[model samples]
Target: MSKRALISVSDKTGIVEFAGELVKLGWEIISTGGTKATLDTAEIPNVSVDDVTGFPEMMDGRVKTLHPLVHGALLGRRDLATHMEAMREHDIQPIDLVIVNLYPFKETLLAGGSYEEMIEKIDIGGPSMLRSAAKNHAFVTVLTDPTDYAQVLSELTENGETLFETRQQLAAKVFRLTASYDALIADYLGKEIHVTDPERTTLTYDVNQRLRYGENEHQAAVFYQTALPTSYSIAQSKQLNGKALSFNNIRDADAAIKIARDFTDAPTVVALKHMNPCGIGTAETIEQAWDYAFEADPVSIFGGIIVLNREVDAATAEKMHKIFLEIIIAPSYSDEALEILTMKKKNLRLLQLDFSQAEVSKKEMEYTGVLGGLLVQNQDVIVETPAEWTVATKTQPTATQFEALKFAWKAVKFVKSNGILVSNEHQTLGVGPGQTNRVGSVKLALEAAFDKPSALTENAVLASDAFFPFADNIDEIAKSGVKAIVQPGGSVRDQEVIDACDKYGIAMVFTGVRHFRH
Candidate 1:
């Protein structure tokens, strides 16, 4: 006549103590193979599934809880005479409370698991049992997640019966946990490496925060995720020691992180202001990269966010401390490095890095705000190559200038369309980025270029994300006196642009690849 409880969990985080509490509360515990073994080791008495259902587990413990006895107990309403009669006729004891957490399917896929391991990790009976209990909430109480263990126990001790509101909240948690879990399985099966279903996006991420406000401070904002595992996305970031990142902070941090990755081997540094690079440099050492990047435009770098592809050492931190930088992102920091950085400014946000794997196992769906609803697309391209290009002008660029032009081209891809990047040998001099017209952008790019008259020869090379729509780009760019250019030449007047480049004695290469990151 005592109340019975079912407990099974893949993440046995707080199980022993939880079982012990149930023992003190006089609840008869029913469990599967591993859960029962764990409870017995903790000296917690439990009834195994075989003993309770009188049926042995089959299919490597998969068929244990799918039996009629388990569902009958969870679904039966003690207040209903017909349910009680059926329970008595079937000799099934009703289960009062169910605590079940599914297998770590999310973690399994994240840890480079094989197909066999993933198939085994997909939970079956656990979610079914939890959902059954949740639906019959008027008669039964269900719990998922070890985080809820202490709170549930406290409520039971505070009052014998759990509050209706608490039951409702726990039911909601059950659904959300299952939904996120299901989303992971679906997205993994259908997405990731390549889309098995292009128009088959079934996952919808729920917001973790309804932001204080959105871009321009007038629109409403919320953030969500597809629950992908181990991707270097904002969803998995743990802000251990800083103020809440504003909408702008997260956006800029993402941009800076990708930019830093462009120069993988070199100690690259990118200083971002308003989601665009204010200064960028690559050097032999992170310390040197930080120094050159800051020197690229010391005035513009003030209050900008700096990202590094390499680790930040004490020397680099020491140099960064002298400025009013808002944030510093890097792969990692040594103890000495953290000590030095913390001393300069206690609140300067220092973010750890995410070294990219070849293919991320997770893919985020697209969503854009419109007048009536949301417009959606996948995240923009991050990979681009300049392998197939043509030399379109008379005087070709030197190999050194070619390399710099390629670097400049890659940097331009992350900027808005019609972006113009001004770079010398080692660093960006000025960036006239995210403009409406290509000519206007080129002019703005040359604004900070007058500083180094020595590098502004008629031989300096230029790179555009895409081709010049008209020969005017070639004419204006020639005025800056840069004589070489690299672009994806597919415009209608491409030959005219080529003629203009030749007339100005400029060398141009068509990469045959276009990267527009709007």
Candidate 2:
């Protein structure tokens, strides 16, 4: 008996050559509509589905290959006597090879397609055929991706049949691809149905790349990307230079981008080390922002990653060239700037990301992996306005001090808890992160501020990640010459903290919302 191969696809990338290769192997080809046309145009011998199934496609080509003849051929059990008897009785020839891919539902939705058009693109017959072939992998070979075509052909040419292990692997890939396709459709329709909290929601991602190592050299990790792009996520960023990105580089660069995204009103620069922003600065130009950020903590930013909200020009690039940085991330860079930076340092990683094309992050979910499971939560992207704040001290903050307080507020939330941020106007003076106690963080911040006197410790403002449990942190802040402070006023010692602030002639405000980043 001659072997039979069924071919159907929405993506016709390698279908012609793939089917032609089957023809060269003496396997009879059975293809549907467009695939049959392609094989015909390529002068490949083929049998049309209508000829095999004895049924014409109907419902605008939606009913093709969905009949018992097509499925029975793919799902027949070659070893079972009863199944072989039924196949002979029904004159159903077993299909040895199946190649199929689904429709463009994801692409159609992303292209701003109409509801009817998107609905029409939801493939039924294609997935059904794939599932049938996958279910009978013990007696069949399945191919879903074009990248596997050459491998499958090589195996067939060498052995006269695909290996059992290769068939099982290809069958597994079919289910994975179909599962993702179904998930995209379900997610899209779930929104229209107003199913805010469906009992089960499906999301699928494909492996983007395998990294060198995880956070440490001992662990292994791989990056995955969503099938449907809903935002300009960092996973979609383009890396223009340097070696392959490690796990640590991705984490630190993500932290820098998150901070830079918050300052949409002006050009912002954030220098990060070990997932903490060491220095942050906002100015009218990228050059000034870089200058202020470098001045904020010249020592801490030695090997840090720098992220900018604006385009990097030649002037900013020249200044950056003088320093050794692990990475630089920005929306864009001028031709001259790119030349100077890449020419100056060969190993510096350059990443270009445009946040404007992204969806609002508040709608997305964040997941943290735990033992045997994951802890899922929403992102903390809420921005508190001045109208929501209350003054907590006897003396009100001056206009300049209040502006500095707000700047510090935004900066402190990104720090780890027990976190403290000290700033003077648009630039951060010092930052204290990952302390066990608030007073310890205060001491760390003040010491850092004192070390960089040019950051202006005299009237610097302090922002705490949470409520101060005692007035000791307040005393520590005053000792550093910080004249203004802002914290969530939920602690039992709020009045005591306020009294201590008044004793030091420091102004204070309560934002009402505590930013506790653990």
Candidate 3:
């Protein structure tokens, strides 16, 4: 009997040419339903799978390729006498190759398909055949990706058979494809029924890019993104100009975007370094916002990532061009602004994201990897309102001080744990993030606030990520000119801290919510 190859695919990319090449190589082709019709229309010689199985496709073509004949042809060991005898007894012709790509489940889910539509798009026979061929890779060749078609054909034409190593690699790819396919189905079904934590969890992501290094020059890294594009995400942003983003660039850009997204009420600019916000400013105009952010910390803004909630105008671009920024991300850019920024800076990455779709989806989750386990949690996208807070001090914040406190509260949420932020009404005066102790962070923030040529600490508000364990934090704040403060207010010594605030005539608010970014 002639060597037979099975071809079933939903993604018809390069399928006709591949099948025609196989036909020219004197190989028999077995196909089902749409694949057979496609090959027949292309005038490619092929045999229907129904003929091989001697059974008509039933139940809307779902039961076509799930027969023993297909499995025996794929799984039979050609080198074993017993296997060969069993195949002969059952009149099963060995299938030398399997080319199958699963149904469009991911695409359908992204397209907002209904539950019934998603269920119908899940491929059953395709995975079964691919797994059968992959498990018996010693005797069968399997292909799921279309990019492998040319190489597989070249090897078949030259060597008349795929190399053992090639077969093993292709088999591995098949298993990965099937596993990802099933994971998508499982995740979708789980979400449909509101199953937050299933007994078994599976996740999948597609490779976005391979970076030169991770956080350091000695480590390797690759970027992976979800199958569907996420709105207001750094991974979803389009690079308009400059060199490809590195690992550090991506991390800082993500931090900057997240911080910028929190201030949608006004034109906002966030300057980030080492995954922390160095300076954040909001104003009536984007240019003014840029000026406030740059003035917040001119020294730290150098070589940092900048994310803006508004379009980049020519004025803002000119000011941003003066600094050596690693990246500048905005919703859009004027023609002259893009020209001015791209002319002198060829290595500075320019990213454009759509801020219109900045709303957080309910299905979004965050994942972090540890030494031997993974931590999964809902994304911290919540923005608390001032109505849910309580005054904890005798002094009350004035109108301007209240707005400044609100800004500081939102800005501090993006900072690392033990975070302290000193700010006026519209700009961040200083930021101290990731300190070991609360008092240490307070001193760092106060020092940065007062170190400037024109100190920005007069009537500034302070925001801490978590509660102060001791009154020493308030004492440190008292040394500075900060007048108002915001914190979670959950420590056992909360009264002592409040008393320290009252001693200094500082107005404090308890949000009853903690924003720890560890």
Q: What is the lDDT of candidate 1?
A: 0.77
**lDDT over C-alpha atoms for residue 504 of model 2:** 93
lDDT tens readout by residue for model 3, 208-259: 8999899899999999888777877878899999999999898888778778
Reference-based lDDT, each prediction: 0.77, 0.87, 0.90
Q: Where does model 2 exceed 4 Å of error?
A: 358-362
RMSD (Å) per prediction: 3.6, 1.7, 1.3
The TM-score values for the models, in the order shown, are: 0.86, 0.96, 0.98
Error of 2 at 515 (Å): 1.9
Clashing pairs for model 1 are none
Cα deviation at 10, candidate 2, in Å, is 1.7
In candidate 2 the C-alpha lDDT for residue 141 amounts to 91
Mark the regions of model 3 whose C-alpha exceeds 4 Å error after superposition. 361-363, 453-455
Q: Which ten residues in a row have the lowest lDDT in candidate 2?
A: 357-366
What residue runs in model 1 are displaced by over 4 Å at the alpha carbon? Answer: 42-45, 77-85, 191-195, 203-228, 231-244, 313-315, 334-337, 354-387, 451-453, 456-459
